[model samples]
Target: MREFDYQRLVIGYHGCDASVRDKVIQKGDQLQASPKRYDWLGHGIYFWEHGPARALEWAKEQKKRGKLKTPAVLGAVLHLGSCFDLLDAEYTDMLAQAYPLFVDSTKAAKKTLPNNRPLDASDKDQLLRDLDCAVVNWTIEEFEKDGTAHFHSVRGVFQEGLKVFPKSGIHRRSHIQIAVRDPACILGYFQPPSKR
Candidate 1:
């Protein structure tokens, strides 16, 4: 990995329920010391600002661990009630090992929405087509309707908007802004380029 000033922190994100929140926070703090040690693909895909290369690395590691079946990456928009949800990377790392199964539990794309206003079909379809990876948003109240809802891969979804520095290789850059963020916090995951 290239040396950078980036600091790894685990921000608290609202869970499906109170118990879930408690468990997540507890895990977050534990992994704060070594956040990168965890296979972060599922959650990092959307919620993180770490860029595409890091996200792809997470996905690759997860696949190696058998945490995920496919190389495809995805993410969720967490609604952590208040914006105060950051734990140290060490805690996240600890959490990753403590609860191996929880790492992949975030498969279903979800966002922390305040209410049940469904996304327009045409607009939503267009948004999905624009992304290079699959995405799903969930809220606390409304449960996602599996069949009626769509799940798509990044190649089948977004288009390029911006470019960011690569995390590890030479002269490589990442494409950004493939889709609009509904709540601003939930930036969609990136379609990381395959190793060159």
Candidate 2:
């Protein structure tokens, strides 16, 4: 009867095409979950936690990649129920422990674990997180097999972009992100307020 519920609510932003945003906000359409194999947080609906600016920036980048025509941001009220928060040391250690298990499973299946690769030589952050994705997905499967901790959401902190200043560890694009595995956790969707 124990649930690892965080009992916290937060505003999350999703970046997409302008049409997609209108459908979800005005027509009440469901936002599709991203299932990319190299997704940073495995397969789920991704969001920028309390970060509308970051979310719009991402949409713009997606447009450059031909993923969308016109960038847009959608706001949502999220309940971080039963979240596997990587910002905490506990979940991070658990993920490290899950690595070998993930390796073993892939080996058993006669497959190789993919590595996180950079987009280009200049891409130091290694945006393609195949290895991280596999381990996270495997860990969730372990929980499912155990039938104890079926997490409804996952939260992670990602440091990205160029340094704001020389000799500074702070990155211009550092932000906290979330992946909602359960659609029910999304209380409602709204139009993001314009920048003040």
Best by lDDT: 2
Q: List TM-score per model, in order.
A: 0.23, 0.95
* Predictions in order: lDDT: 0.28, 0.90
What are the per-model numbers of colliding residue pairs? Answer: 40, 0
- Candidate 1 per-residue lDDT, tens place, 80-186, comes to 22211114354234334434332244333352212222225533222222111111122101122534322221011122222245553333222222111223233
| Candidate 2 C-alpha lDDT tens digits along 1-196 | 2343689899999999999999998798998788888899888899999999999999999999999999999999999888899999999999999898888989999998799999889899999999888889889979988996888899999989999999899999999999998888898999987776
lDDT of 2: 0.90
Cα deviation of 56, candidate 1, in Å: 1.2
Candidate 2, residue 6: lDDT? 83
Worst window of 10 by summed lDDT in candidate 2: 1-10
